[model samples]
Target: MGAASVKPTSLPISELLSSRYPARVPRYQRAYAWNDTQVGDLIDDIKLLLPLPAGTRGHFYGGMVVIKITDSSEPSSNVYEIVDGQQRLATFCLLFAQIAARADELKDQADSQGDGEEAKKLAVLARGVRKSNLYYQRYDVDEGNESEQPRVRLSRVDDDFFQSLLDGTAGPPSRESHELLENAANLLRDELVTPATDATDLADARGKLQRLCDAVLLDSFVIHIVSDSRSSGYRLFSVLNDRGARLTVADLLRSHTLELLDDHASSREKAANLWDDILTEGADLVDDFLMTYYTSLTGKRAKREDLFDDVKDLIFSATKGRVEILAALQKMSGEVSTFKAIHAGMWPYVPSEHMQSVTEWQRSRLQRLVSTIQHKLSHPLLLAARAHSREDEFAKLVHMLELFALRYKNICGAHTGPAQAVYYAECKRLRGLTNGVAANFAALRKALNTLIDKRAPDPIFRNALKDKLRYDGGSPMKANLKELLTVLEDYRPWIKQGSSGQPRPSMINLIDLGQVSIEHIHPQKPEVIVPSLTSHTNRLGNLSYWAPSDNSAAGNKPFALKQPAYAASVVSFNQDLAELAAWDLSALEAREEQLIHDACLIFRP
Candidate 1:
């Protein structure tokens, strides 16, 4: 525990990976958790150091704390457990594996070209500078010890999959960690290969690839802090994480809660497992979930930076001991899935066992609507309602929220302040109903209805739907237009159905509408047009969904020339357009009126 017992050394990854002392990410540690952004950022940073000189050092890759788990004096006999820096270390291993693979591929190309000298050079690069930099040999004669092991061995959960990344035999990911690992490998491989694969000059590409390898292995450095024992390493890990520059709310909260449970090893271990499960389940939404989960439980709006303090306040106020704290965490763990489901627009449908009565259309509707609007403020309320209400009741709550977001936020362009206040208040009220009685649901529904009616009155909503819903070239309007057309297509009576009466496939996909274009029925820039109809060209009635090809081909042609394209289209919106006898202001106004009526009826609370 003394400063004398701890030793820290600054070394390049080349020295670390080339050393006989192997590093191991403990089984209980979290899996390789960096997402695509972090992985890409690391590669991009290294790319800045490209064309590295022979003896020049590149960027410092920060630090890691590892405990000497074995007491053996020989390096080969000792193993270091990674208490911190698993993500970085694992990422580097992945980087090296990809570079090695790229080098071997080039070597194969050289061999096929009958260039023995280039082939030999690439083979050395593939094997690394030393014979065993990527996978060091264990010199210990212990019968149980394997002859060769990866310099950085990941946890048991990801070790096999990590190996598959090196060998290039990975299949679909069965879990989140597996997916992350695969993504990192794929991203790194793509970056490493693109230059070499695209180069016309083989020697230049090979030199660049060599510099990349050297930049990673010889230039990038980390301060390797060696600890005397696991406990000491863990204490240092806690200190480093608390003061780390990139410390997150999840990190701070986890460290504080675990430190509080340190007295009971059993409770601490159980809590650690539960924490990992919740983090994995939350995935990229971990921070968002922390804020929303806290808000939902307390019915108070919490900022991300202030979340740890807010959570600590709750912990001190509500819990007395480790058991009580653990119980509180267990309850929080139960709600993580609900938060994830809500963010994914799945809600009651995710836990399908408990939500048997929730129909597929209901789930799809929420999913589509959520994708079309900014539903961040609605999360806390949705989480609270899902926790307190039954499936049927929660379905009603989701519909109410969707209508509010679509009408008030998306179409009417209302300010978010008033809506946020109403949502937070309802969240608090719903959380107060611990037993979730019928009267409580009724009250919440009534309040929500009143808010919706007040914010998005019939006349205001109808006018917006008819006029403001037109395409204005902004992404928000484009999304709103797509949402409107997709809903109309879903409600169209002519849509084909199965023998089982399930609705036909939708003409436009609400989730990903990038390929679908909003066609101007009246022609925005017509080759021939009546002067009076020019002003009505951008009306909601003038727009309908068209495939990119049809939109390009129509090309400002008059409705006469566009009629054949519309008649050939399968989209119900276009089919409706084909039925029109001629293009005029009267027809556009009539269609806009009918659309307004249908939208009002379909989105009714």
Candidate 2:
């Protein structure tokens, strides 16, 4: 662990690629993931630079690339582990290979047409490009190995496919191959074969390709940073690449965790697979899951900027050995699905035997609570409770969480700063309980009452619902209001019973709410309005759900005209509109009071 020597210099893309030092992406690195967007951007950048003055020097193509130098006994060559910019290096190799392939194809065409001079010139250019940059020249190594391979080798997972692309023998990418690498190759091939803007004959195409090749090899430059060890390389990589088009917190964390487990390959693979499984849902969600998990375990908000540091601390502090660290990560990974299920509002179908005693009704309630509240503060609490608590205890826990979140944050408009810490602390407490489900359920209720100021009669929530419920137009709160109304509608005694003697809530087709739009009971711009009507137009009393088509049709219409649309609605809230004799301030107040009363009961803690 000696201090790493660092050197920074600008190198032409050609010198960087053609240098005797061969680049290798370590096995722990993620597979090549540059898709069409990235590939196209690089092409566009190079194409833009191609038309610049021939003498233009030091044109920056991209950010820095950091390599960890490795000792090679052979004097003729060197080997370096790619610490950063593997994507760019791999892509450059593919682009250059495609250019060489296109040049050779043009050479053969010219020779076939009896154009010997043109064919010879093309052949020389192609040979020079390939020989100088694309591959290693024959050399003897001290370890009895001879070198003659591609100048850039990808991570083991992608090396074979990358080599195939370099050799011009790749078929259409197989399902098993990395899609991004295939896409990058396809993008390069398409650009080389057919110019996007200007159609070119064989000669013009060759000229354009040669210009691109020259521009990339000679004109485009990168800031090359060479480090001596993996740790130094990673530090440099973070400093350089943490800015534009950056790696995510999860990416850096994944690399760090895998590096720690390097000596235990099987353990490393297990951790890697678990990480992949977490990402399989979506790459962006891993950070979210981690943040939630971290908050739950530590009872502190995990900032994205500090996520890697915090995770490293947690892993190392929990256990010093790699085996213990891997075991801890495996345990954390196992809980990922539960968080994911909760995030997706799919707790009912999570397929865990622990959830078997939890009824569909309870799951439905949990889903509604999560979807409506739409906050992350309660996720850790709920997830930890689900993992450690029994079904009945989990049901009670979800109820307490739903009440607190909806009442305190949603309706009361309280900031989540205090609540997040409390919820996280509760998560830890729940995890520690021996009879966690039942014991923690009581603990959560008591904590909510103490920390959030749970009043005996709960007048604070009811008053807040009445006074602060006015949703701003086009705000997310307006949507939350509609969802609240739907939940209240379902809770009404009017819901019909099924043959099984249970309330058939599914009869309402709540999925339609996803498409339904909120409408003003009192027209937004009424043709006839009594005094004080203007003030009440956007209040909760004035709003009801309507189908989009119906809402549009009822636009600015008088109450009498809009009554027919309300009468045809299935919502219990809308049905009350049919009985209204007039759309006046009194009517608005009456409806508002009734709705508020229902809400107080529906969201009662």
Candidate 3:
């Protein structure tokens, strides 16, 4: 395609709505999910900085916020595929639904819901939402099986997130229809309805929302990038992003670190070459060496999470190259050992799955290790590791990981087995060793192992160690591992620490821990219909963790249908029980507060 063009305009982006995607473009084309918080942050920005002012420039710091679009051949239609702002658009529609539902109650409270006329004007603005809007076509798969056909057709979301917006739906429509109405209803609330009603007191707040939308035109700038292909786009995207403060992984990989050469093409070319070289994985080896060298001097870090900044620090202290870098990598072994020694206090508590009880300790260790490695390059132990020994250290560490990986593969094979106990034992053993080179091996082993357990140490517990952490960007390893570990936890007893603080004393209580088949608090499938657990998404508080067996039994059964099972398994559904008891309303009403009231507590740390 030719270079994409940028032209901003202000209208009631309200009328701008129409199907804007190629009908054939499939969900797989953009197969991913965005949670409520990400959506919430957008609204927060809109609200906090009304007229979402030219708050920040887009091209200067580009961020791809994807949206789904469809084209409808309707008269009086707007046809434009969402280019850069899909995430916010989709989420705003959802939030608008919540705001519309609460219009009447919120009429009195301005900050909470804006003014009264804004609410009414919004109602007038968003009349036939259910039929016109297409977001409401939600269905549940099945109750017992994941691959089953749908049972309940209209079910859009699980009890929590779905029920939330429904609580305070203000008017003539059924809760579902009213919600659909709110999707566009919010646009009216923000752009036209609310601001018009305000004279002075609400002057600023009233037009604020609408003004924010319009700001994108005047304030938002475009890159109008010239890239030949997807690869170029990816690299350009990363390069532009890294130049800003909020650097991403791809940014670290793409960043040139030199000042932008708007004036000097030669300088730009030089910088690009250096960046391309370092971005290579082999360059990561160089990066490691540099980090060891720098951390040897100052105290800093270089982790993927904070790699861009860390890389910045290490490169700043460039001690020549080849000779110095090789020297630094050689010395890195000792530096790793020293770093480990400094953070040893956090080890005992660490061998456990999470460090909830030791947040300070863990965060501190994370910071220190990052700092120690990248800054303290010449430290004696590192010098040895750097001297042709970096590869050996890398290999030794790799072997330990391979062993652990093999064990992980085995545990995953046995669904409902006690994977946590095995993992914990391995961690403790690794931590106890303190040899110079071996410690680095052990440290690497421990770090990698920690990554897995973080996602699912004891499956029953809610620690979601990320899949992206260990598997080197492949499939969803954590999800698969969780499924595997769940099996072990189901069949085995609780794995606890021995008096000697070992992981394998006995199996006492707890399900193959958190391992088991997918539990549908509200199951969906061909035969068994349950509430739409995944639909009408709100904060995940609505989606409680459940065992597959329990989830299956609860399928399609309204709380009423599942009452007997609920009574029988009262002990098993701790979170669901606590939440229902807290809400005090068995059948949900049209009150946003109820959902918020019940949910806010469960969601926060």
Candidate 4:
């Protein structure tokens, strides 16, 4: 049950796959995640050996760690659970599948050309490649019943998709991992047939494919590390990682947490599966989720490099026994759906008795406001509030956060350090709060409003709104500017009447309009430049959202010429601009003043 059962053996990939035991990536293992760069690099390295002389020493492909999951010793009866190097092994399987299929295509071409000898040679090469692929990828478990099992079985999350790739039945990828797998397959195909190496005939192509197949199957080497127990396998995996092997923060956390579980094998496996589900849900953002979740609970900053250490400390400090530790993780997993909804800028409807009072509109508005601002510093606070506070309190918290962000982040250009400190403090408080605390909301509002007044007072916001705000398409100010204009568009409709002095049209979600573009009221390249007003061309007061076609047609035109398009626009902000008396410095200043005043009122915390 420990280190004595661990064994290490060096083997070429050929021997490793040709063994009787079929390799299985345990359910807890992460899915195939090699990007195009990694896949291309591996292929390039393998291709480097093709030009070398025959019978050269095999290239070292690194280690593959596995554990014998079953005790049966009969041929093909044992399953080696892959603990590490699945990425490399899965990638090799993909490459072999492509080679076999390409060889088959070449064989078919030769047969059609009436070249019996070439066809026979290609058919044999195809079969050889197919056999190697079967050893690494899939083969029949029962010859009589024709039941088959993959030699290197991927996790349940990806086994089906990986199989489809080998069988050439994969459609467009439906998830991030699937996309990476598809990209890897496509990259291997590209490397297999480059422009410089493309053959002129079926025979030459067959030769080229055979060379690649041989290079892969006969020339690659790996250190096959085996263990008889899961705990030993994980310990070996961690030791290898500590010795400079690359593993992600999420991977380390999962491994460390599982290592702490002093339980039966079934319980350990269940915990591993639960961790995988959480990891899979987080996907690329798993590390961020871990950091934010831990920091929210602890009221301390968790850097990316120190995430595992922080979580480990928190686990030890918060739990007293094995059951409590597992429950702690289960509680953390429950918040994943909420975190995902916030990350995606969408309000998820989780049915709960306390959530019935929280209307969809309020939730939608909260999400839209945060999304428009696009700030991650607010995520931990929001996540903590959702987890600890009642649904209505969470809604109120969102509104306060939106106002603070609009003034402090969007308008006044302040550093995130100050706001992050306040947010973290609030998150810590929220994490400890019981349900239905009206006094906490009052204290939170006071703290946020106080911070707003200090960081982005009316005078500061006015000064920044006057001229410091500028946005070209490529500038980072584009998001803030869009958020400002969208809010103004909404605000203007409520306060101003229609063209016929009737009620204003209902407010629109200007940010979501597909064709909307930020148009300059005083065009960037006007027909006749007013020297006094040229400096104000890209200012906040000079910009409004317009349809792309209208923005284009009115480009660089004078105020009078642009007035017709603005008047016909659907946006209230644009329509109001059409009512200006003249396109002069005085007019720009007056409008700027009005906007500054309204912005202060609209965004005041």
Q: Which candidate wins on TM-score?
A: 4
* Pairs in clash, predicted candidate 2: none
Flag the better candidate by TM-score, 2 or 3: 2
Ranking by lDDT: 4, 1, 2, 3
lDDT of 2: 0.69
When summed lDDT is taken over every stretch of 10 residues in candidate 1, the lowest stretch is 498-507
Error of 1 at 236 (Å): 3.9
Give residue 62's lDDT in candidate 3 (0 to 100): 30
Q: Candidate 4 lDDT, tens digit per residue, 282-301? A: 35577778778888897888
For model 1 the local lDDT of residue 316 reads 31
In order, candidate lDDTs are: 0.72, 0.69, 0.34, 0.73
Question: Model 1, 36-131: lDDT tens per residue?
Answer: 889888888787777558466478888888887664634555788887788898888787777778778788888888988888988888786434
lDDT, residue 12, model 2: 89
Quality of model 4 by C-alpha lDDT:
0.73
RMSD of each: 6.7, 5.8, 23.5, 4.5
- Give one digit per residue, the lDDT tens place, for model 3 in 1-605: 23342223332223333222111111111101234344344444444434334544321213332222232331212122222233334443454443343333234454455555665543442332322322322223343322311111111221223233333434443333234434434554564435533444443433443354434323433232233333333344454455333333333433333222323555435444443333333333444544443433333333444555554545423333333433433344344444343323122122343433323322332222222122121122233232223333423332233223323332222231233343333334433444553534454445545544553233412222211212222344434333223323322222212113222212233333233433333333324433443332122222233443454456554444555555554233323343453221222222223322322111111
State the TM-score for model 2.
Answer: 0.76
lDDT of 2 by residue, 96-140 (tens): 777787788888888888988878888887887777777866555
Q: Local error of candidate 1 at 406, Å?
A: 2.4
In candidate 4 the C-alpha lDDT for residue 300 amounts to 85
